[model samples]
Target: PSEYFKGMLSRVGYAIFFIPFFITYVGHGFFSPGWLLCPGFYLLFLIGLSLPTALLNKKLVGTSLVFTGLLSGVIVFYQVNKLSWLSWHKPQRQILQIIEDVGTSQTKTLQIFDCMAAEKNATSIYRVVGYSSSIQEIFWLNHKVLPEIQILPCSEAGRSVASLTPNIIKLRWSFPEFTVLTH
Candidate 1:
C-alpha cells in the first residue's frame, strides 16, 4: 500500500475505534460498564465485517492487530480504574459498623432513608447504581442482618418517621450525612 493510503486508513481506524466511546459518553453523560453493551456489539459487528478486507491485505491485517492491542489496553485501563473506585464502599461499611455498635438485639426495627443519595449526586462519573434491595443485600453480605430493616426513599422518609413505633430506630443517612434517631 502507498504511504498516503496507509496514513488515511490508520486515521479512519482510529476514528472508528473512538466512535463507541463517544456514543457511550453522549448517551449516559459518562462512561458506564452497563452502557457499553450496545456499542460493544456494534464494534464486534464492524470487526466481523472488516475481517474479509483485513485477510485480503497483509498491511491491513497488521494495522488491525495494532489497533486491537491499543483497544485492549484502553479497556484494561478503564476497568482497573472503575474497579478501584467501586471498591470504596466506605458508606456501606460505616452503616454496618453503626448497626453493630447499636447491637441488633436492642434495636427492634432499623429504617434507612436517603441512602447513598449524597454519593450519587456528588459523583461526576459512574454514579452509584442501586435497587430497592441494595441496602438489604449489603447488610446481608456483612452478616449483620437486622430482623426488620426498611430502606425508605427520601420522599417517604417524613411519613415513615411519623409512623415509626417506639421500638423502631430511624436512621436518616445520605452517605456522608448520617443521623440516628430513637423514638
Candidate 2:
C-alpha cells in the first residue's frame, strides 16, 4: 500500500517534468492563451534533464544531459524561426529578408491592424533579427503612446515555421490603450 503512493508520486513527478515540450507543442495548436497552458514550457526543461539512457547515452548521464540540452536548445531556436529545426522554408526566407533589411541596429516600424479584434488599434511591427523586449522598450521611449507589441516570426533569424500559422504572437497591448498600436 505504501509503495502504491510512492508509485503515484513518481508518475506525477514524471508528468510534471515532461510538461514543457508538451505545453509548447500544445500551445502551438491553440488560439487564446491561458495560465493553465503557459507552464508547459518549464516542464520542457525538466524533460530535457530526465531523458532515458538508451535514448541519449547509457554510460554517461551527465554527457547525455548536456548533449540533449544543446540539441533541444538548437531545435527550439530553429522552431522560432520557422517551426522546424532544420528546413529553410519560404516564410522563413521572407521573414529573414525583412529582418535583414531592418538590420540589427535599426528597426523598421510598420503599422499593423490586428486581425482578431472588435477593433484592433493600428500597431507598428518592428522588423528586427529576433524577439527581444529591450528593442520594444526603445521603440516605446522614442515613439508616441500607441498600443505597442513586438512582432517576431520564428523565421526572424532564419528559423522556419513548420506550419502556416494565423496569429503567431499573442497581443501584448489592449486596443483601448492606444489608437495607434505598434505591432
What are the C-alpha RMSDs, in order, of all predicted structures? Answer: 8.5, 14.4
Query: How good is model 1 by TM-score?
Result: 0.44
Best-fitting candidate, measured by TM-score? 1
lDDT of each: 0.57, 0.37
To one decimal, what is the Cα RMSD in angstroms of model 2 from the true structure? Answer: 14.4
RMSD over all Cα atoms, model 1: 8.5
lDDT of 2 by residue, 1-183 (tens): 354345434555556645554565663432222333334444344444445435444556457556765765565565444422233243334433333333233333432222323322122122111234543544454443222344433233223133323323222222222122221
lDDT of 1 by residue, 1-183 (tens): 364355444445545666665654674454455455445545555554445564546677668756875775578568647545454476556665765566445556667676544446443211432433665555455556645667676787788777867767777765443577553
* Residue 181 displacement (Å), model 2: 15
